[model samples]
Target: MITNDVLRRVRYALQLNDKKMLEIFASVDNAIDENYLHSIMEKEGEENFVFCRDSLLSLFLDGLINEKRGKKEGSSPVILPAKAILSNNDILRKLRIALNFKEDDMLNALASAEFPVSKSELSALFRKRDHRNYKECGDQLLRNFLNGITERFRGTSGKDA
Candidate 1:
């Protein structure tokens, strides 16, 4: 559960103004209105507004925005400081685990989709420093890789097992 302070903080971190926040929210499909977001921020707070940390994460993942806060110095202006925890490795790890695949298997799947990744490369991808590299793979490549994996693994499950 995020507090109002946290919500306000994230907005500040994004360097977003009220109008820009409204625009960003509006851009998302089926996203709540400005008032709805405001009310949530007012009531439940930032945590409530963010149902999927993964989505908020994707914005960072795509390099579309930064998620750091500014710190004030002694009687000086705010200094932008980078927050060091904005990677989507957890999401990737979870996806790989759900598919019941090892790093090599995922690499193979990615390769099958023309991603041509190696186990070592895959491991690197799971690290924070490789975010820029992963972003370069673009959403289309990631989507294709996911689609291929799910398609290949679709019928390998048994219900009530």
Candidate 2:
């Protein structure tokens, strides 16, 4: 899935308005202007639909971590590694940290979207890339997880993944 879709889903899942969206971006010291944000949120083929890049999404996720888990005291903020690619696994990992979800919580979240998964399967998604048990997270899985979050937090699964 595209980064813009993830951004839109996350925004809807948490019911964040424009002001809160800007604040979330600012929480990690990347203060995105409202017009830029507006373009990012625009659908494809719109006059000003700008593609959301992975690095920007990474910063947003970091900002989300700060917003949900509280920033570490006296510690400077960390930016994404220059060579890092923001994969679906990374996105899920960041969400897990921000939400303080346990394994069961994650399973429940997945199940909430009618995508039941086993604990061991879920664990593989977090394993190191070179590890024998490592599993790449697919777009469908990520979409389902985001949909699950929407179901849990918004009490409705109205948005398409």
Candidate 3:
């Protein structure tokens, strides 16, 4: 999935305005320019559509964590990996943290999207790559999860992210 699209969907789901979006960027010390923000939000093939990097997406997620769940006091800042890969699993995990979803909440979110799964399957998504039970989250799964959460928070799933 496109990182820009993920950011857009998250924005819609969270009802983030331009100023708030900028603030999210600033949350990670990445205060983006207004024009750049618009470009990032622009749809693909649209004029001035800017590609959103995985690192930026990760930063946004971190900022989101700070936005939704208050930043922990006295906690050391995390050093982002050198080459951030915003995989579906990573996206889901970050979202789970940002939205403060518990096990049942995560399940319910997926279920709300009509994409039910066993607890073990959900756990596998967060497992290390070397883990035997590790499962790679599919695009469909992430899409449905995002839609479901949109419905849960925004009162409607709206369109695809």
Q: Identify the leading candidate in terms of TM-score.
A: 2
Local accuracy of candidate 2 as per-residue lDDT tens digits, 54-161 = 889999998898899999887655676776779999999999999899999899999998999999999999999999999999999999999989998899993653
- Regions of candidate 2 where Cα sits further than 4 Å from its true position: 81-83, 158-161
Per-model TM-score on C-alpha atoms:
0.36, 0.94, 0.92
Better of 2 and 3 by lDDT: 2
Candidate 2, residue 135: lDDT: 98
Candidate 1 C-alpha lDDT tens digits along 86-119: 2235445544543456767777666655667666
Provide the overall lDDT of each model, using Cα atoms, as 2-decimal numbers: 0.44, 0.90, 0.88
The candidate maximizing lDDT is: 2
Greater TM-score among 1 and 2 belongs to 2
**TM-score, candidate number 2:** 0.94
Q: Rank the candidates by TM-score, best first.
A: 2, 3, 1
Cα lDDT over the full model 1: 0.44
Q: 29-125, model 3: which lDDT tens digit per residue?
A: 7889999999999999999999998888988998899989998787533546877577999999999999999999999988988899899999999
Model 3 residue 131 CA deviation (Å) reads 0.9
- lDDT for 46 in candidate 1 is 38
Question: Global CA lDDT of candidate 3, please?
Answer: 0.88
